[model samples]
Target: MAWAILFLAGLCEVAWAVGLKFSEGFTKLLPSVFTVGFMLLSFWLLGLALRNLPLGTAYGVWVGIGAIGTAIAGIYLFDEPATLLKSVSLLLIVAGIAGLKLSSH
Candidate 1:
């Protein structure tokens, strides 16, 4: 199903994001390779999802989900900024994604 593929793509997005952090400016071999693979897989699934979902809606949701997911991972796993302001911003992104899904129906 397209939804399942999209969800997988989102997970890959998260993986690649963590990969990027470990990439050490792409000098690290394993993480760099994994990052490339995950990035390719994520985009491929996004393209497949776009075959049925509207481009504007699908792209927006895909990007929003990836951004929010990656930001949360960065904060919790990487000790990046986790301020209340960042939390509010992430919630806003989630709210927007929810709104998009609701309006699509």
Candidate 2:
């Protein structure tokens, strides 16, 4: 399904984002390779999803997934503060994503 593909693409976006952090400006060979590979795969999946899904909804959901995943990963992996404000903001993002999905019907 296009939705599944789009969600997978969003996960790949999160992978590439983490890879980029480990890449250290692309100086790290393995991380750089991982980042590049995932980047390509993410875009490829996104393009496939675009065949049937509306661009605004697909892109919005994709971005929302990446944003939420990256923020959580940053907190756990990089010791970023998980403050109440930040947590609430993330919840709001999730709510918006949910609203978008629900309204698409």
Candidate 3:
């Protein structure tokens, strides 16, 4: 359950990250508001998950999820480069997140 909440938080992190691009330095009103909202929700969910999960594992996984999701969003939405090295790096992050989960509990 904690892991599930942590995953949701990570997804919110991704939403806020992409939201930043849409917000345009917070100049856009609606996007900026959504961004701030997601940021708060992400933090709140993370706090809840922390009650049961180890800090190191939960934080690492959360960051890994955000990084991967944002990178994918950038590639798809923003026409960001999707080089081989970047793909491999994302895979490495996934591996690290998995390792942390396996090492925990």
Candidate 4:
């Protein structure tokens, strides 16, 4: 349940990040509004997850998901650099998150 909320929080993070890009320095009203909404939801979901999950582990996983998912989405959707080194680093982040989850159990 906590993990599920964390995952949703991560997904919201991704949405808000991409929304930021479309916000056009906050000039674009719709995207900026959506971005703010998503950001709020992200934080709310994170708080819910923290109710059950340890702070360090949950925060780490939440950040890991946001970082990696956003990077991948940026590269694939926005044609940001998809360099080999960056891919490997993302893989390492995922591994670390998996390690934390396994060890928590």
> Evaluated with TM-score, which candidate comes out highest?
3
lDDT of 4 by residue, 4-23 (tens): 99999999999999999999
Which one wins by lDDT: 1 or 2?
A: 2
- Which run of 10 residues does model 4 get worst, by summed lDDT? 96-105
| Tens-digit lDDT string for candidate 2 (1-105) | 998999999999999999999999999999999999999999999999999888898899999999999999999999999999999999998998898788777
The residue ranges of model 1 lying beyond 4 angstroms of the native Cα positions read: none
Residue 93 lDDT (model 2): 88
Ranking by TM-score: 3, 2, 4, 1
Give model 2's TM-score versus the native structure. Answer: 0.96
TM-score of every model versus the real structure: 0.93, 0.96, 0.99, 0.96
What's the true lDDT of residue 76 in model 1? 86
lDDT order of candidates, best first?
Answer: 3, 2, 4, 1
* lDDT, model 2, position 101: 82
Candidates 2 and 3 compared by lDDT, better number: 3
Distance from true location, Cα of 35 in model 2, Å: 0.3
Pairs in clash, predicted candidate 2: none
Residue 46 of model 1 has an lDDT of 90
lDDT of 2: 0.94
lDDT of 4 at 81: 95
Assess each prediction's global lDDT (C-alpha) against the native.
0.87, 0.94, 0.98, 0.93
Cα-based lDDT at residue 95, candidate 2: 95
Better of 3 and 4 by lDDT: 3
Candidate 3's C-alpha runs over 4 A off are: none
